[model samples]
Target: MPYQIQSYFLEIKKANLQKLRKDIWSDTPVPAILQVGDTRNNIAICYRGSYTREFRKRSYMVKFMEPNTFSDAHVIHLNAEYRDPSLFRNKLSLDFFQDLGVLSPESHHVNLIRNGSLKGVYLQLESVDEIFLKKRGLPLGPIFYAVGNGANFSLYKKGKRKKSLTSGYTKAFGNESDDKYLIELVKQVNNTPLTDFPRIIFKLIDIEKYARWLAGAVCTMNNDGFTHNYALYRNSKTGLFELIPWDYDATWGRKVSGGIMEVDYVPIGGKKTNHLSFLLLQVPEFRTLYRNILEEILETKFTVPYLTNKITSLHQTLRPHILRDPYKKKEIELFDGETEVIFQFIHDRSAYLKKRLKYLKS
Candidate 1:
């Protein structure tokens, strides 16, 4: 057996899926549980809405296996040895994101056992406000587009509006009107050799826009964002953007060994010496802008406390599991200190960038 009984319970607290059944074949096909796109495990999304203040009055969309639901879904392989791991992973990813500052849809654990056999693991996630390209517009997508030198974002021709704002240095176009400003920023990010000497000192950086992005970055790392993960959002008709993160099973500062967090920071220095700082250097103008933004926000009473409380409150009941094997457990240890690490990181970043980008100011 990959793990004993008690070991399974602890792992159950932190993992995405629960242990259900092991068919003689890995593909025996249970009718209830299914794979979730978020975890690549068999799953389903059920009802989600709103209830409490903490969750921004939003209800979670759940992933579960209901009886007799598989025929409609594309059949996929499940672990022959146990329940789905997605049960534990998604919530953990949310907890981390909320604490770190990325806006994640609400996530909760769903316990459903057919006749008390512990049949399935369910993830209740927050419903995202999507401005469908065909119906509305996808402006908010570029908010998390990770714009910089050498970064590439796929342009959707069909849904995209396809009107240019700036040409030559970079091309800015969106499939819809809502996407106009967002796409303009991402597409026209290249350093423009201005005709008149950058008339305004803070003209290059939009503090508000970058603050929103910095908050989102904290959410990304907490979610253990993978290369493919993207924050999807919608710029509501009201104009305020609604952002939600959708990816997990990659974070929590846990490596199989917990040796160290091996983050590939943006490259910096020069042509010969590349570094993670290069990500900032690519947008040197933005550095202090966000610093000022962060400062202004911190002065207000609304920031930090909500995020701090959210992560702390959910740390125990909401921890997700990281499986050593798809169907088994070696047990990953939980570090409560992740919140402090993240906050300190953002604070230090604000301080550092303020000094670094001071040159851009008058």
Candidate 2:
């Protein structure tokens, strides 16, 4: 069966479009009309992402006005994915995380049309917010995004004490009072004595859930996911924090700039920058659990044969659209060969992890 790419039409005033382009760094959204099929709604559009803002084909964040939503999402991210030639890494990583029983945003490929002009293929990602939790039958809670390196679960940055404990995070959901929860979590993670760390941390976080998330990041080799490119939600019922993966275009053996990254680039536990993971691994029980999770994932999900089939299927589905895409037509050859690159990455990454399982044991 041929893959169907949903088409989104954006109607924006020429003045607003120029204003948005003039200040690529601004988060302010310009009023626009969006149409999908026969459905139409008012939306606020703005440029999103840090480095990708400079790209000719930039990404966008669309906010649907009240009483008007697209696919039950009040907000959605349209990623140009100009950096990743395959344009499959982010969705692939999110799906893999879901398979491991972790909460992750849903995404699919869609064609975006701006002012009747084809802007090429984009990955439409469901926003992780109150609606996301309600859709999954989960309770709403305080949600914070790790916006920068200061969200390393530490009170310091670059060997100096941080001026604010909440420097790297932006509260996405909840009131001003909810900020204390994240602040307290960071304090406990950094100041808890080694002998009493496990007892204290088990109350703050779900170790198994964190292990699964860590394992997913390790398998995908997402260098930036540990300290950033993720979200934390404190479950109101359980009062424990859980992780939600995000912004993973730089995974699956590729760097953010679309360059080749070695299979063993990131350590099994994760980057040392994250103090939470560091403290968790210090407890033997947590280390064992994390290692076991990685082993199970490697044996089942991360194998080359398993992923090759997935990569091949996605490659076939995207080929026709990719060839016709004006921005991507020049790199048709590179796009066609990306499946093999991803397969080789799976093979080498799995082998490296299998051999390094001993490190986790020690």
Candidate 3:
């Protein structure tokens, strides 16, 4: 069965397009007109991603002009997903997080057309911001994107004291006041004594949500998720921080460059660089909760049979469009065989985690 995907057309002035191409590192957006099924709106678009900007098929960040939005989303990410041959890892990881009751971005595959030419299959992701909160009926709060390795919830980076506590985060939605909150949280995470860590940390962040988010990241084995590639949102009702995952293309047994990775590469506790996760797991209660979350997900959503069906469905839905996509023509074989790779990873990862669940008890 063929999956129907919405197509978006973008028209940019030749001069603006040239400028955008010339300055691939620029954060500034270029003016463009976007049309989808008779609705046209002025938008600003810019290249998105770090190393991915150098790829032949680049991703884009599209911001809708004020008072206009696409499906209630003021901004959207059109990811080339050039690194993932399967082109399903990011969507899979996000859906997995959602299934685990974690607040995650919603995504779907879409065909992007620029200057009357097909830019190929792109995963359209809902941006995490104030609008995301409103749509989900959640109270408005500060949202920050962990943009670099320094976002490891530590007071120091590379053995040096960070000049600013919030060095690695970009405030996606928040005021100057929010920075103090994040700074305080990081200070508590790193400065609080081990004996007093649990109580203080618990009050600063939602431990249960953090555990689940940690388990989700561990399960997907996202190499960069713990340190960065995540969003922190302060829950207005609870006044505690919660996590939202992002940039998960380098997951599911694949490295950022699409190379195969050992299933057990990421430890059950997650990367050691993330001080928050490391500190939380030190408490027996948090460890047990995280283990339980992983166990439940493994028995249910992360199982071979369950995920095989998912991978198969996604592969089938994407196969037709992917084969027709000019950008991915050279890697059709890898795309075709990606399901098996993912299935193998699931089997190995589940067994590895089940065996290691004992470590959490101590």
Q: Any runs in candidate 3 off by more than 4 Å, and if so which?
A: 1-3
Better of 1 and 2 by lDDT: 2
RMSD in Å for all candidates: 12.5, 1.0, 1.1
Between candidates 1 and 3, which one is better according to TM-score?
3
Superpose all Cα atoms of candidate 1 onto the true structure and report the RMSD in Å to 1 decimal.
12.5
Q: Which of the two, 2 or 3, has more lDDT?
A: 3
Candidate 3, residues 1-362, lDDT tens digits: the string is 44578889999999999999999999899899999899898999999999999999999999999446879999999999998999989999999999888999999998888999988899999999999999999989999999999998998899999999999999999899889999999988888998998889899898888888998999999999998999999998999999999999999999998999998899989999998888888888888888888889889988888877768888998887888788897789999999989988989998999899989985
lDDT of 3 at 318: 87
Give each model's clash number. 41, 0, 0
After superposition, the stretches of candidate 2 with alpha carbons farther than 4 Å from their true spots are 1-3
lDDT of 1 by residue, 1-362 (tens): 12111111111211222312221213222223333322323344221211111221111222334432322322111111122112233455555445445455554544333222443333433333332222233443323322222222212223443343211112121344545654444343323333321232124333344344444443323322222233424343434433344544333333322232333231112111111122333444444554454445344312345445544554444234323222223332323445564345444433443344444342
Candidate 1 residue 355 C-alpha distance from true site, Å: 9.4
**Residue 172 Cα positional deviation in candidate 2, in Å, after optimal superposition:** 0.8
What is the per-residue lDDT of model 2 for residues 103-217, given as tens digits with 9 covering 90 to 100?
Answer: 9999999988889998888999999899999999988899999999988999999899999898899998989999999989989998899889989989999889999999999
| Candidate 1 Cα lDDT to native | 0.33
